[model samples]
Target chain A: MWDTFILNPMINALLMLYDFLGNNFVLAIAVFTILIRLLTLPLNLRQQRSSMKMQEMQPQIQAIQKKYKDNPQKMQEEFQKIGYNPAESLAGCLPLLIQMPILIGLYRAIIIVLGSTPQSLFELTARVYDYINLTDLLPISNKFLWLNLAQPDPLFVLPVLVFGTMFLQQKLMTPATKKQESKGKKQQDDNPMAGMTQSMQWTMPIMFGFFSLQFQAGLSIYFVLSNIIGIGQGYYMRRSMAQLKEEQATKKPAVIKAESETAVASPPQQSKQDDAALDAAMKGTPEERKQYQPRKRTSKRKRRRR
Target chain B: MYAAKRPLRRPVIFLLIIASYLFVACGVQTANTNWPGLSTDGEKVYVAYGPEVVAYDVESQSKTWSFPAETNPTLQFFAAPSVQDGRIILGDFGASGGMLSPGVVVTLYALNDTDQGVPGSIWTNGELVSDRVVAPPLQVGDQLFVGTANNFIMSIDATTGAKQWEFEVGHSIWGQPAYKEGVLYLSSLDKSIYALEAETGQELWQTELSGALASSPVVNTDLVYVASFDNQLHALDIQTGQEKWAASAQDWIWDAPAFADGVVYFVDIQGNVYAVDGASGDQIWSQQLNLPVQTSPVVVGETVYIASGDDLDAENPQGALTALNVADGKQQWQKTAPGPLFTTPVVVGDSIIVALQSDQDLLIAFDLETGGQNWDYLPPQE
Candidate 1:
């Protein structure tokens, strides 16, 4: 099932890419990596959006946890009120989990396509689709820029690059623990997810970098290119999220001032509750967020005209 | 509490990743160890499959001797051993420094053919090359010509295991070097056929074909017949390396064509066997078996034997030895084996010996005239 559905399709697609892409295998790999990343963009965006939403609701979540420590059902109800699903937060790992199969499949595909041995070439004959003129394509060019794609890189350049790029991507994808940074060790103690993500940020890159040391340079090319693309996607997502937060903050000053004025008239404990509620409202629904986005766009256009 | 359990998640995932990597790595490593390389010297047939190289006596149908006596896990032999005058020469695929070293070093060993069932090394070329030797070393009198996977053709003294001369090609040479009248002919995966001086390893002439040649060139007195991945069998001029005529096949012609009595017989990877006139690349007769045949056709007298296997990755992988009339391409008889018969069968006396990919029967002997199985032998795995 794996071979027919995932591996064979991937192998043929790579071969097709190699055929039309002027036989420049490295270029083919780069383009294919970008294409695959684009295909999985929706999943990545969903994961990123979920993570951002979870990050935004962190303070409110902590408040609920502290208040409803004695009432488990009430804590669950409060989490729902803040539009936070713990299950959805766990599903944030889904995008990476889905990518695992793609990585494994592409690894096998690269090994077969850039096969340096006869037996591997022989096995490739069986894996190739009938329409492909494998006779001409026999012995896919493994050479590119002093690197034999079939073998591991000797200069140690790729491994280091893989480590650096993967580390950067992981850093970007990992939700910044602003609360944890401010609160220090106590915040880390309170939120296990922060600790897990931090550990993963280092561990994942180191693990893949070690893998790149042994794996074929072609696979390392895939890793490096994939990580670079991920970095771009991560940068875009973080920028958009930051813009959205900025727009929300900019549009909410008048409402926040009005609430603060009403809170000053009310009791002290009510003022604190109102302030927390205002913060939750600031991290509002997609509808509320989209309303402020147009104003930021208009302001940018006005600045451009100037 | 969640924080305590969270640390365990990464360790579990890391273990899974490591396990998956090991599994994939192990599978890929076993996929292309270059099948069993079989060769014969009229009296004994040598089989080099995995860790050991063993020789089987043709007449007695028993083991004559095996080199090293014990299998080394690191060292693997896949190239056919060149047996000549009580000396056997072969090269290991490679052995690395296990976990510490990243480089693989291949060694060439010259062993004395002994009466004691275990051959001793005459001279060992320890780490002579950094790449694997996929092509069998061709023994020409005192010098041995070897082709490596890393695009190097080496000439080593057969007696002392000393380097004679080394020539680098454009790509890997998977076919054994062919020698004729002090001139060496080699087909490379670089899509070119190279002619080199046997004594000096100097390039004489090179002929670029349409596609890569994985099989050795069959050189007669006049022409060098090269089967290539271009789906064509090219006849090149022996002296100048100019293409004379080419015969097309359905798929890649992976092995050297057999030349006997002015006729050249070869099989494509798609199992199409064709007989062509050696002088002119005209097809005389063609037969379709519809199975993958990577081994060269062995023509003894009037019968041509071809070994074929169907889908090595299949659940019940099967192979056969089919004997056909050399004149008409008519089927004489066919015998099936338990596993894929990848190596070309070697004819000795009245029986033809074939190497199988199965563990149950590593080597099988069949009657040359009749389709009856003579005997089957499996070497010691230890």
Candidate 2:
């Protein structure tokens, strides 16, 4: 079902465009990139929503940490007052995991089939290159300026572009945290990427750049255009998520106490009520805190960008 | 909890594998390992190309006397021609090649004479279905012995193309039948060497080898030399096809074996050409060509000719036909042409005609002594 309904249809559609465009392989790759990015828009929006929610809950989370600064056990308890799970941030990258084959398959399509190297492809292997119209974008030549759409660029332009766009897309799509959690070196070791998720975001582009070195120029073009579209999509979804966060301001604060820096300030009249609730949460079993506590607004903000 | 992730990872891995295989499977024929045609004496030259038969003047460096495969369906050269008794015989291997699956029975044709492009049909002879009768009928007196791709080594009357005898092998036969005295030496993909009674089609004896034999077995009195894909040149007893001796090489030895004086000359696909003592199967000298050498070695008296292809690239594309001194393995002279070459060299009368190929898609003839252009007849440069 997955192959027929999603992958093959998409593959055949790209091929049809390649055929229709007179085998213009470059345009086919560009159109394919645009189509896939557009298809995943909804899922991208949801991830961004989650991230936005997480970001909005940050102020309240900061207050909770200050309140129990010296007591390690209390800080952990106070953190439970507003929910924050670092592992949950990784969930925002789920769409990439789902789209991995499409990305890699398209890369391979450009190399093994379209922009073939004589030394690598062996004889006795059945080859069908007619399926793609690589010649149509004629004057667009697989060679543009210094780029050889056929082989990986030796000048490293394509790969660097791939790397730069990937990092930028990661930045624009992943919600930035207002505060960096600094524990002792021990805490840093416990979560190896303590603040490095953002680093990994940039690292993805660099890694993709290396892949570009061995892959074809047509694939690099796809990746660059895809990231460009993704950035635009992220900004649009971010605005929508910001509107949702504004509406939620009327409701009870939704934030993990440790993450709340501004939302920690509740009305003074409601302080006694909040303190009583905090005492109930403190007395309650850990599982009870997990079940009753609301999701952080910052998590939603994180989700929004995701 | 991780067990749930296992199935999820499986699909990702499976999709990745499928994608990689697809990438490897889709490339085009960006370059030709070669385009081998026949020399004048009806011998297949070079490597990989089949139907190893040629005539001195008719064949170009290209695979066909005419355009091999034409987009125009109506323009078919149904006449497959070869020479016997100074006449060119023609016939079909009784099947369709290229895109179609051919039938089992093949038909053949014979020619007597030609002046320029005009030909006088010497005789019309039909014998069963034998597609690859590439080597002109070896007309030893009256018996015309030839090999066919349809798995038969048949002898026909030199005058009428009537079947005189037939010998069957284990698998389909593609190499030309090498003849000397009353014995006909034949090679088969079945990995067996056969010494057949030239007159009766009776197998004198057969010796099985380790690899498939593709080149026609060249006989020098008591020793029979055959090149096999098994990477070894085998010298068997001429009378019984028994192992006389063998020397292993580093690459696929597809070049036809040639014997002169006491030395044997052969070329490997890696461009290594060798001279070995025919009496002892010991290497005397070895030399490498500029690019891969797939052309079978042809020796006439003191001169041995072999063809070499150039490094196929967007620029500086060319190929060569080299003639060497048989005794010392030193090059006498060479002929260079543009693009990849697979045509074997055939020495006939005053002209050492080499059907050389050009990027212009024409078959050119070069003077044997001077290496100058002799004849340029083909379509314009493609």
Candidate 3:
């Protein structure tokens, strides 16, 4: 069932793409990765939005943690009151979950399409549909740039590019914590979770770079291209969000300006109820906070755009 | 409380990503490693499987000896071992730094029939000829001709294993070279066949075909019969390398054609057997066994024997030795095995020997007259 539904289709599609792209396997892989990214753009956008919302709630979440340091059950109730569920926040990873299988399928497809060995070539002939003519594509020229698509890049250029692009993408996705910058070195050192997140930002790319060194160059090409495309998409989305924020600021300039002045005049005199509500909204699920607070009409506009 | 779990998510996701990386990394290493090829000297059968070449004695129904004695993880043999002058000459697809590494070395080893040591009785070993060797070596006189993944047909001294000459082709040569009367006929993945001088490695004539040739050509007195991936067989004139006639098959012909008494018999990968006239290239009769056949048909007297099996379907995959009358293409007898048969059947005296590409058996012998099981041999389990 897996072969019929995923692997065979991917292999045939890859072969078809190779045929359509003038038998250039490297071009085929690049085009295929771009097509896949475009097809899953909506899912990626949703995940990005969910992540941004989580980042936006970080300050209030930290405030809630500080306020309820001694009351664990109360904190749990507060989190529920704010409508937060840990599981629901993880919905942002859905795009990645969907991409994993496709990536694996593409890897297998590239290997099968290249058909490096006699046995594998025969197996490819069997997997290929009869209508898809690959006679001229037999013994595919794996040479693309300085790499052989069937083998890893000999010059280490692809691995380095893959690492660089992936790191950039990860850097764009991981929201830098302002509290960490404000905290003393000693406090930052004491927080193991913060340390782990920082380490992961570097480790993920290095690990993938290691994989790119071992996998076929064709697959590595896909990885590097997909990472670069993701970075571009991320940048575009971030810019759009920034533009939306600017438009909102312009529309409600007087109200925000007055709040800023009042906030500056007496930082500690803000109402405890307002603080509690903000904390609750931060702890709550994105949907729950949107329902409970209902302060921003732009959220509805954003939904319409999505 | 949710903040407490937030930190755990990163580690979990990290582990999941690492797990997936390891899964794909490990999965890619398990390529299609089985390309079993065999040769027989009428008494002993030599089969190449992975890194070891084992010689099975037909009479004793046991392994006489295996090259290297111990498996070398870097060494992998796919081409059938050519037995001549009491030596086993074969090429290995060697990779350094684990199985996934791209560096491949086609090392040719000539081992004595009976010798065991740490390095184990290798008479002469040649340096790397190419990235890989998938075609069986052809031994004529004192010269050994083997085609390589580097698109070169190399001639090595059979006794000393020294490279004598090399002929570069348009693409990789996956088919064994056929030699006749000072001329060598080679079919390549470049969709062309060339006639080269056996002594000097000079091309005499070349003829382009419709598709890449994956099977070796069989040379008659004046004609060379070769099969290609285009699902057609071409009979070329040996002297001029010109296509004399062409015949179509059901699928890609991955096995060499067998010729005897003006009739040429060949089988495609789809288990469709065709017996064509050697003079006119007309299909005389064809039979379908519904199993994929990678081995060429072996003709012994009036019976044409073929090994057929399907490895793709696990549930009902069948392997059998089907014998048909050469005159009428009628099924004389059929004997079934536990798995696929990828090597050609060799007739040794009264028994027809076949190598199985399955876990249950390594080689099996059947009675030529009755198609009854004589004995089966399995490699020593490690």
TM-score of chain B only, all predictions? 0.92, 0.72, 0.88
Task: Record all residue pairs in model 1 with backbone atoms less than 3 Å apart, i.e. clashing.
Answer: none
Candidate 3 on B1-382: residue-level lDDT in tens?
4346556766776786676466434433324376577888878888888768888878776677877666776567778888877767878765443333333334788767753232244554536474578888998978889898768898887877778899888777888898889999999988999999999999999999878888889999889999888898899888898889988997888888999999999988888889999999888999887788888899999999999877674785658999999988899999998878877777788999888777788788899989999999888677
In CAPRI terms, model 2 is classed as incorrect
The candidate that achieves the highest TM-score relative to the unseen native structure: 1
Q: Write down the worst ten-residue block by lDDT for model 1 chain A.
A: A289-298
Clashes of each: 0, 79, 5
Q: What share of the true interface contacts does each candidate keep?
A: 0.23, 0.00, 0.16
Comparing 1 and 2 on DockQ, the stronger one: 1
* B337 Cα displacement, candidate 2 (Å): 1.0
What does candidate 1's lDDT look like per residue over A1-306, in tens digits?
Answer: 999888889888899999998888898899889989998999999998888777555545655554555788987976786577889988988988999999889988887787666777887888899899876775677778978787667677887899899999988886767444364443443455665666667777776766666677898999899999989988988798778757866888764343223211111112355445544554787444222210001233456999
Q: Tens digits of per-residue lDDT for model 3 on A257-277?
A: 433332111112224665566
Candidate 2 C-alpha error for residue B38, in Å: 3.0
lDDT of 2 by residue, B155-186 (tens): 87767768888887754454667888877888
Off by over 4 Å in 3: A62-77, A80-83, A179-197, A248-306, B1-30, B72-75, B98-102, B115-127, B158-162
Weakest ten-residue segment in model 2 chain B by summed lDDT: B95-104
Model 1 per-residue lDDT at A113: 81
Candidate 1: CAPRI quality band: incorrect
Best candidate according to DockQ: 3
